[model samples]
Target: MSLLQTLPSLPSDAAYDLVVIGAGGAGLSAALHAAIDGAKVLVVERTAHVGGTTAWSAGTTWIPCTRHAKGVADEDSLERAARYLDRVVGDHADAALRRAFLAHGAEAVERFEQHSDVHYRPYALHPDYESDVDGSTLRGRALEPLPFDGRQLGALFGLLRPPIPEFTVLGGMMVDRTDINHLLSMGRSWPSLRHAVKIVARHAHDRLRHPRGTRLVMGNALVARLLHSLAQRPRVTLLMDTQMREIHVSDGHPGPGRSIEAVTLESAGTSRRIAVRGGLALASGGINRDPVWRERHLPGIPMDWCPGAPGHTGQAQALALQIGARHGQGAASPTFWAPVSRRQRADGSTAVFPHFVMDRAKPGMLTVNQAGRRYLNESMSYHRYGLAMQAEQCRSEAGEPGAAAALPSWIVCDAAALKRHGLGMVRPGGGGLAPFIADGYLRHGATLADLAHQLGMDAATLEATVATHNRHAEAGHDPDFQRGVTAYQRNIGDATWPGRNPNLGALTAGPYYAVQVVPGDIGAAVGLQTDDQARVLDAQGMPIGGLYAVGNDAQSIMGGTYPGPGITIGPGMVFGFLAARDAWRRCRSA
Candidate 1:
């Protein structure tokens, strides 16, 4: 969107030392470190801009044994971290790659913070996904990108991708963990009110000169820092709207002797061929949007409900597959799971929002099936929650909860919850419900039975479900699902409460509310199989030279388990750096 954009023109025969096929966190980190290590790098992106899924993420990096990990009063060592992973990840994890990651992860974090525009701070309160597991802590081991001023990019600031409009406030103004707290506490606290006012005023001024707020935070800040760092490097060239059309393999695409020679690309409606001297780093998110690949990899899951970036059609993965690269199979999940809510916007387009860290674990709410029974603990992480949703669907196929209502189940809540926690698009304090209700994104009724009727569920069954739920919730214990019992459950639960239970409260006050809930994914879990150094492995179990993968483009190191808040972003960056490093080493050795 900036008028000061510039694209370098390469000669018809010119080639770079390295070509990174995606501009997300992994790709950008690969480019930066590769350039720093003295490799001439060129990044080509399919979309008109950079910052693939990283721009739309929480930007938390869950690396073990980093300095910031210690800064948060949490003790983390290589052995302890490996033990934790062994317990959680089990046999599916590749020991070699896991060891490589643990050894180099701290260096990756430290190097970027020291030499690049990137910096991070560990969470003082954020806990591990498996907080109860050995070597896990309640307040460390994850790093978040420090907030960056987008104004530093000058005219090119607009080029950095923006966050989802639903995740933002006041139209397009970006906010973070602290900003949300301030906004939530506004009207009750003077400091919070002033903080909100300052942000509003800043956004208003920003709107006068820009299309959206410029105070980037979270994932946007991380992308901006990586982009800024890339811009500062003279040897790196980033080409947007350039897509690799075809790749030429030296040995005709199969066997252990296969190697890449060059790739044909289409840029700005013109085709260009560039010889690849080192290798291609594939980090184009995953197969969340590729209909064909989705059917092959993650069958039966609706692609429209997912919250991944539209550019993540798995082009990179497909290209590797065309070159005889084997797709990793038998992983925990073919894709990372999440709970997503879809709402049709005013412009006749549907908006998909990921339920990352809001509203689920709050008090006075519960998830139920059509037969009207609580299925799983509602306070668990979104990924685990999706697995639970799938389990309930499988269970529904067998017996009792007849009609299999849990797959497309409903999140049942009360007026107190609507006024306190807000469900998806329905804002807190019961505001903005009419429009959402008009669009049928939200449903409400004077009683639990009426709400269930609106949801096509058995009224009597739902009434019984809520009654039983209310009794146990009021007692601060969940006899059926055991909600709010773990550190993770209580961590996401509401801290400001009057009773002993923070994640539980009686849903007795009318009117009751219900929202349609379905399982969705964040990224592809199973990806191109790769070696310890991030080299793409063929079906014969041989590493493919001149070909590497990172992020969701490569099989997950944790085997798709949601170990922490920033697991996706963490390995993406680490293996990305490793991909470039290995490629450079190979080229030098040759």
Candidate 2:
């Protein structure tokens, strides 16, 4: 019997007009919008729950020309946005594709807010990755989610993931840089007072009545709220622990009319195929967590930075490949890899690269290789960060006499830096930074040379680098490397400093500590190619009927560089909105 014949058929249920694969920030955004357009929607998630890696994200959505940019109306323009993108992505991006993102991104945000519970607060404060680039305004391009009550999620709370404890979640938390500084100040000013009391009180209340203990709210808090809105809708059906195995394609008569008839899914011990008369939207996230695929696609870098779901192994990508979908080629390998650090959870298992890297509450110190040499700019963009790590490894291999190999860099800080800038090394429930120091994970040394020896580096070289850096610190000018020069860098730097460079410091104090740093990735930037409408393209760059991808699973339209905080989610939502609109149009036309 054929595979279709061998499988028991599902009952003649109502054919879903739309099938969205992943439930991440991107996938859910697409599904909610499709449902709003009055399409019968079914969202399938591979994990036991939904929310994907977004639950752990900082929840900032970056968009240029947003309502927040109204004050600086004269500074930003569509042409400027285009120019900035051209400089960053270069010839890698198609002009049409870039135009699509810029033109539709604002509309998509407005549409999402109108149809769903995803309310956006215009943040006039966020910075662009490169503020100096044309169309790159200092503000008005980014908006973050307003805090929501997780208690509303109810029993569905267990179906969602919780934010890491190190992050504050009470009082509608915003994980931006300023919020972190507030958290730190609260801790220091009132040492005896509970720093996060409001958050804890709300969390405790939710735990008492809610089945999941705490309601989940995080990065793009509005996105999660929006998903909750859809879950409450009578029309939307969310299937947890279900995986889409393949898409059933119809070989239509030779024309621009071939389409998908249904999608086959595997759940529990049984398999069922759901007919897709309208269209199938693949928002299943990227291939950042799949070790096998990472080894194949991004062989050069370590898989450290991925904050995506464990099941986000490109199942949708694989399904597309099986359907003869053509893959796009550019750099032959992933230009960026998510860099993360290994943090041991309470259960003994390790959680890699929580939002601490981006959280202002905890400052991310500079990373040095095993040989105690600084390799890359600590404040560089994530894509550039990955490239720097890889370059460091290459330099180590060349062995130009006595070069230190860059295996994994160390995040060094003195007691003052630790106190001023929080370290993510605290125990799950325990307060204070004792555990990290008590355990060998965070090593403390009295002097620069002693710290170098402890980190297994050439003592003289490390001492000299520190001394030279100190001279720059004393003069309040970084000559060798401009550490706190850029807005992006200064945004993450120590705001308490009187000088312009917030990231600059002497590192002259005793009891210096070092936390080993690894290349932690947010997600893979490369994936299957798509058009401006989020349509999957074949080898000839033609749209594949009934197949569309958005978010990380789709090749980043911005090439490998991150223009702003929400660049990933912003486009993901925009393309997702476009795909839903196009799918509706296609279904209605048929």
lDDT of 1 by residue, 1-590 (tens): 22222243676776777888888888999988898788888888888767887898888888888888776655668888888888878777687788889899999988898889999998778877787899776766778899998998986686788788888888799988789888889989999999999999999999999889988889999999998888877888777777888887886666668887788888667888888888888888877899887787666678887887778887778878887898876677777888778888878877887766667778888888767778788888899998888888877777753436576778878988888888876767787687888878888889887887798877887888788888887788887778888787888888887767788888878898888878888888888999888999988889887899898899898887888888888888889888888879867886
Worst 10 residues of 1 by lDDT: 1-10
294-376: candidate 2 lDDT, tens digit per residue: 78866655554455557778778988877756555563236344445566666886666542344221232456777776666
Distance from true position, residue 516, model 2, in Å?
Answer: 0.7
Show model 1 residue runs off by greater than 4 Å. Answer: 1-8, 251-253, 400-403
- In candidate 1, how many Å is residue 401 off? 5.3
**Estimated TM-score for each candidate:** 0.96, 0.90
lDDT for each candidate structure:
0.82, 0.68
